[model samples]
Each structure stands twice: as structure tokens, then as C-alpha cells.
Target: MLTSTKTGTFRFVLVAVLMLLLQACQAGEETTPAGANAGDETSTTASGTQTRSDEGGTDGRGGTLVVAMTAGNVPLPDIVPTEGSEGRRFVTYQLYDGLVRWDLSRDDATSVPRPGLAESWDISEDMMTWTFHLREGVKFHDGTDWNADAAVFGLDRILNQESEWYSASLGGAIATYTKKIDSYEKIDDYTLAIHMKEPYALLHWDLTWVRFASPDAVKTYGNDGYIQHPVGTGPFRFVSMEQGVNMILEPNTEYWGEVPKLDQLILRPMPEASSRLAALQTGEVNWAEVPPPESMEMLRQEGFQVLLNNYPHMWPIILNLQVEPWDNKLVRQAANYAIDRDGMANDLLGGAANPAVQFMYEGHDWYSEDGTTYSYDPEKAKELLAEAGYPDGFETVFVVPSSGSGNMWPLPMIEFLQQNLAEVGIDVEVEVMEWGALIQTYRPGFPPGENVGGVMVSTGSYAPMHAFDRNFASTSVPPAGNNKGLYDNQRVDELLREVQVASEEEFIPLMKELNSIVTDDAPWLFVVHDLNLRVVASNVKGVVMAQNWFIDLDTVWVE
Candidate 1:
């Protein structure tokens, strides 16, 4: 029998309770997919253009919307946020605009690159050089003109270590996106060219995360002070913040694009699901992110909108390849087979997620049909384990975060998987840790604890090329990139190099092939893709809930 040093009975009970509640509440009502017009109606804008309005039937203008985030601590309002992806979702995306941005206006399976600060761009024939045409008449919140010089300054802050304003801390967060660029220069007031070390086809997608900040504000506030008083060219302008409590923003009337409909946007940090649920019930906040799974039906019944949509997110356990048995491919494949993804998705998450067979969702453009399919087959798992010379499966430890952004009910989920893996003879000891501490393990040189086999974390599979490179590239290991697992495959590495220079038509097939190889290798235990759940008051309007981590909030307003 598989034995665990850790007691997970309480977590198992919590999962059981959630499952029972979900079974009782499931009435065949499917989650609203991205792009679906749920409670939306057609309305004409002040400019006489027809547009969709939120359920409240208003012009989506003029109200304060307060949202409770999953972070326990409020993020520093800077170019690189402090609270992992949650910081980017709540703080960075709101306060800054990249040269390129995700097309968050539509509800689609995939969000492509759209113009943000840069109105347009061009690429050289060899694809090694890119020239961006900045939008004229745009000014940062600090009243600094956003010209090519400002863009170069922003790039140097992350890419050039010799620059006085360069930040090693912020640079690490964006290394993957900025690594390929050899250098950048201000060609003119409105144009800049980024010269790559080699041909890179995914520059546009990578640039989406390379957001620019006000150069003048950085100088005045200094490096550390800039985090406190951030200035950017986004639709929302920073107003005030109360440390770990809340941060407030107001719309910029001089915004080049559409101004925010809400007069104010307040973001609060509430890590507990119960706290978020209670806040929603008491009308303390207009929106709550990642509410308790069992409470979704109740929230909907109470006239609140329980929103769920498909996004490029996956909750997986990144195996430590240097660890014993995990170094063996058969043992890794067995663990993948041991997982019961459907039960975890439908039962525990209340259908708020989809089972992940590959890194990408089944219907995604880059998802590979040729990849190995990991079904819930305990017998197959046992057979594979026995073949790998461990008829009686081995014991290992898993480090998991109790809660965080894109991490959906991790305790219950891990407990459920513990039971499934135990049935297949893989005894797992669970080690729970804080989200911030768990995030530290993702960096280079973080030692895996004694007997540690894997770390459970959620990762984004959006930005196809970057995602592949970050997770599977050998060069991406630790200090260099996000390849935390230290997985190395010669064929995979070769394919990655080819894809960087491949033609647009050749890219998809190469990615699909790479996906197949990685799936077969089983470097990580694939679990499920989150449906991006949130609860909003019925009075809240014009929330698009795009199929992305980021959303356009300028269209949102309180009714």
C-alpha cells in the first residue's frame, strides 16, 4: 500500500464536500464560453457607433468598480509587478501599455497581437529587424511625451545592464521576452527599430509583455521610488494606494484611445475565498475573482453573474528531472496516466475548468492531435510503473501553493490527485506553502527540498512560440529562463531553433510537432485548464471577460 507522511484526510473531506455540492447544483447549465454575449445587449455609443452594452443596459460609463483580487498582498504599481501573474493582471496591465498588446476586445479562443502604444510595425525580409511606428500625441500620466527615446529608455531598463536605470529585478521577470534582441535604437521621434541577434518570428507576441513606463517619472522617483509612484500611458491613471489593503485608479481623460467608462477603479487584496464571497454578498465589492467553487451556483441564484471562460492557463506539477525515478520516462508517463483530470475539473472545480491532455487546450490552433493522450487508466499506470522496475511505486514529495492566481483550489485538487496516484502505487507526500514562496522555486538555483519530486504551479500556454521556448528550451533552464523542470531533449531543441526562423505557414506544424514530443516525454504532469472564473454584481456592466489573462477594463462601468 502507498503510504504518505502527510495527513490529507481533511483536504479529501473538503474535496468530497465540494464534489457533493457540485453534483447537487449541476443542472446542465454550461459555462459561458469566451466571446459569448451573456446578458449583453446592442447599444449605440456617443460617437453613433453600434456596440454591445453590459446587462444593466447603460452606455457603460461613469461608476466606481471595486474588485477583490486573489493576492494576499497588494502589488507594487510598477512595470514588473510583485505578486506574480496576479500583479500583472491587476496592476501592470492596468497602468502600462506595451508596444504591442493582446486583442482583448473580442471573445475568442486565442488573442492575437494588436496595436497599443505603437500604432503599426514593419519587419525586415530576414525577420531579424523590426521597426515600430509609435502613436503620435500620446503622453504619459506624468505629462512626459512618449517618443522613440522614451521607448528606447524603457527597453534599456530591462535589456541593457549598463544603463543607469536598468533593473536586474525587473529584467528577470521579462528576460524571456527580451533575450533575443541584440539591441534597439530610436530611429526617429515616432519610430524605433529592434535588431534581433537572430531571426525571431514571435517578436510581436513577446512584445506584448514589454510594456513601457514614463522615463521622467522613473528619473524623478528613482529606481525604488518608481514602484510607489508609477506613471504609464494606459487608460487608467494611478491615484492612491493603502499598502496591503487597496489601490485606487481613475480614468485618464487625455487617454489617446477610448477613455475608461468608470470614474474610479479600486483593487483590493483578499486571499481567502470565504472573504471574497462574503465581500461579494455584503456589496463591499462589485467584482470578486476565483470565488469558492461550491458557491458558484449559490452566487448565480442570488442574481450575481458567475462567469467562466476558456483561457490559456494550465495547473500542472513541474517534475524535477534531476530527481530519481522522475529521470525515467516511463515513471513520468505513469504519473500522467495516474491523474483523474475529469473528476478534478467537473467534480472539484464545479466545471470551472477543462481537462488538459496536452499543454494547449484541445481546440487550440497549436494543440497537437498526434501527441500522446493521457487518459485516467490506473491499470496502465501500474503496468508502466512495473515495467520501469518499480512494481511497488516510489514515494516522493510535492510542493504546492495553497492558493494563487490561476491556481484553482489547489489543496482539494492536490488531495484528489493524491488519492488517484496512491491507487496506482505512487505514494505522494504533499507540502503546502504560500503562493509567493512557491513562486520563488520557479527561478534558477532554487534547490528542490529533500525527497522533492515536483512543484505544482499554474502556467500560461498563450503566446505559442514563447510558451514553447520558456518551458521546453534547454537554454531556458533557471537563471536564464523559466524551464524549472530542467528538461532537455536534443530533438526538441533543434525544432525550437527552426521554429524561430520558420515561415508563418511552417510555424504551426513545427509547434504541433514540438508539442507532440514534449507530451510524449511527459516532463510535467498535465492536469487541467482553468475556465477563468469570477463573480460580478448584476449591476456591473460591459465586462468582456476575454479569453486571456488580461482584459480591457475601459469598457466596464457600474450601473
Candidate 2:
């Protein structure tokens, strides 16, 4: 039956009462595949531009946009404590909003930040201190007043190294400007001043991710508080969460902006690739994240919707530079030249992966175009191996995750690289481990001499400071989470620090230098930066997709 609802006002009375009823119902079985008629039959373009019709409707009837995701197994927090699986990001966006959202209007992938909790902000001439004018008449999901103190509490909690939410990446750079935060003083009830130790240009955008929590919710929930009962000044309100099962988010009635049209949002975790796709196909779920290429093609061909957007994330081969065989620069360079990235992008990934020539993607405004790019040459690889004092090639163990094409998982691409390395006399013993175990095994402390050697890791970067400092910094040895391979270089470290403070012109040179050093050192065979395939149902409307992962559900409506 085709039915529609109006946009703007909130729907459903006694929504909280029905939350338990929805939770009680188990996730539906995989949907049966319908024939390919799901695609739009009308293929007319506007002025020669063949664009997908943006008529928001997946099914004729509308309610919630049930999204199937792999993150079901992983217990994600409502507010992001640190760098985590992409699934966790969905919940984070629903609970908290950023200061200035990614401004997608800019060509350079700049964040088009709209006023969230803060109405306006002013930067000092010296660029040391920043004063934020908070928006009055805002309230958390729990009905607590949203004010400057709430922002301070959130920052203080995350910045504190002792707090579990304190990510090492944020701590490294944010800690440096601790002197700037003289105090989180309330100028009035709606204003806060953040004094800085030094000048930080990206402070405004930085506040976008810096979340604030309600004091009441924290005290009530305590240590494990936000998990079940999260409160924030966002478009949606947290209803309930069942461990290892599903999460439910309802539209916040007091939301200051355009209210979400859907009465509720249901996120069901379906880890298996096939099952997730099946759910999307049968209309059991409206959308799914990171569907397999085969599934994506099937769905697209059938008229199902698909969205391909770039992300500031990469999947690279992590080389153990501290180990003996790989420690040789020639072997690293040979391995770099040996692997076939183009084949991986087109074949294994099904044309979704972008070949990563440098550490950062061209999408990132700061990426260096003049950086070195190692081409695929089997003969050159063999020559370099022979020059590195290993004429007969060397044997090593290669580890990868058994799940997820993007992270902790092995594909046909791994098999190809293994074959390519074999041509140079390098024998690879491939080992498949669960994703969590793989992460733990590679993360710094593996006992003194307990070397696991080589593994394929998917490391993501959003900011340059952490990208350079944590991944390639000299002092960033293991256990602290910087050096999984325990690799270190003093010159690279100097350049990283220099780039952090350097102007746009100076930073480009430093970025180029960093790339050249990594290329020469050969610690990793730089692979590809990925583009996330976001599938929104036809009924869902109003979202600005960009390279950065910031999503605004408030603007989304069903009509």
C-alpha cells in the first residue's frame, strides 16, 4: 500500500511506551531478492547531466529508515570516546551535534559548519583565544539546559588522559595548546571563552567533534552512564539500547531545527555480508552500510539506491621496520614496487577503491601532488631484493582479518600481492585472524622479542597532525598506540612537528618531504583510499554528504 506522511512536525504520541515493543521483536530474516526492476525506468538527464532522481522514497509507505550495518557485533558508544569502527559514528551523530558541520559547499572539502549549540564565535587577532557565543533556549535529551558549562564538562572529560574517552590522538595535539584553555569561563549564561596556549587555526572546526554531556545524565548513569541513557542537543533523542542486539533513536521534540520526519530510527547489526544485503533487498531494512560489491551491483541493477562518497580513510600494508628482513630499505622499496594496487582497486574492490600513491588522499586539501609514486615493476622488485642482500628472497608471515573488506579482512588482493612477492623469491605464509584479535596482536606491547612480523591494517586519518605524528613519528613506539611496527625516524618526526605549525605553503613542502621519506624507507606498501557506499532509501530526504563523516540527521525527513 502506498502511503505518505507530511514533513516538519513530530509524529506519534506515546512513542516511549512503544520502544520496548519494537525491541522485543527480533530482527527479520533476510529479504528475498526481487527482479532488477527496482531501478528507475526513466533515464532522462537534466541538460546532459545523468543524475539519479532524488525523489525520497524507498517503499510507498514510510516510518523509520531501518539501516543494516556490520557494527552490530561491536558495542559502540553514543558519544565517540576515540577513533572507532565507522558504525559507532552513526550513533554519535544522533546523540551530539558539532559546532560548524562540514561545509560541503566549498570545493576543497571544507566543513560547512552551521550553528549548533553555539550561535556564533569570535577568533582573537593573535589567534590564541576563542570566545564562543552559545545558543540560548537549548536543552539536552534529558531536559537539562544546554550551556557553556556542559561544553566545558565534555571537553574536560575527554581531554583528561585518565578518562576512557580520552583518545591518544586528541590528547597529543589538543594537549599542546593546553595553555590556551585558560579556563572554560561562562561570560554570561550563553557564552564561553577558551583560552589557548598557542595559535590553532582549526579550533572552530575542532569544536564540531568536541561533544558536550549533560551533568545530570552523567551523575545518574555514572561510569557506564551514556551507554544506555545518552543526552545531547541533537535532532534525535536516545530511547533505548539492547546489548548485542539493536538500538532505537526517536526524534527529539524540543529539537531547535527542522525535526526528523521519521518517528524512529532502527539500527540492526547484521555482520554477515550476504545477510545484510538480503535485509536491504527484501525491504526488511531500508539501507545498509558497506555492502559487498557483488551485492551493490545486484541492488543497483535492480533499481535499488546506492551512494558512493570518499572518506579520509585508507587500507595499507603495515611493514615491521624493526624486524631484520624488512628492516633493510631495499627490501621495503622492492616490496613497494612489487605489489599491484591497480588490480586490487578494479578487481578485488570491484572499482570502488582509489589507488593511494601518497599517505594522504588528493581529496584532503593538504595532500602533496609532487610526492613520489612507486610504479608496479616486478623486475625492479627482484633487483632491489638482490641488492638488499637477499638474492634468494626471504620468507615471512602475512596476517589479515577474516572479516570486512575495508578493515581486518583479506580479499583476492592479498592473494595477488602474495603471488607478486613470490616472483621476487619472497615466500609469504598467510594467517587469518579475527578482527579484534588482529588489532590487539599488532598494537605495541607484544613482549620483548615477540614479533608477529607482517599484517594488513586499515588505518584511517581525518587530521594531518595525528596522521603524520602518530603513524610516522620517531618517538611513537608501540603500546602508546603510535607504532604498531615499532618504526621510528628522527627526520620524519621533525618534519611532522614543523608541518603542524607551518603555514599552508610551508606545510606542503613538509608533506612532500614526509611522503618521499616514507616512499624511500618502505615501511608500508601504500595502497588505496576508500569511498564509502551510503545507501539511503527513496523516502529519506535532506542530507549533505561529504568526504568527512559528519552527518546531520536533523535535516533528513520522510515525505
Best by TM-score: 1
Poorest lDDT segment (10 consecutive residues) of candidate 1:
20-29
Q: Model 2 compared with the native: what TM-score?
A: 0.79
Give the per-residue lDDT digits (tens) of candidate 1, residues 28-89: 23221111221121121112211222456646578889999998788888888877888898
- Model 2 has a clash total of 25
TM-score of each: 0.90, 0.79
How much lDDT does each candidate structure score? Answer: 0.79, 0.59
lDDT of 2 by residue, 1-559 (tens): 2122342111111101100001101122211111101111111111221123253553322367677765525345545532245444567667776554433322124333445677667656655666777778888888888877777666666565565444454344334223224445667777787776555444543455566667678767764655567787777777776765777889887887656666788877665666777777788887776677656567667766666555566778787776778888788888878877777665666666677766766545445566667677889989988888998888876666655424522444566677767777887766665555555556543335745457777766544444555577655556434566767788987776565345544654565677677666767777776665556566555544554555555555554
Local error of candidate 2 at residue 131 (angstroms): 3.3
Q: Candidate 1: where is the Cα deviation over 4 Å?
A: 1-53, 445-449
Cα deviation at 398, candidate 1, in Å, is 0.7
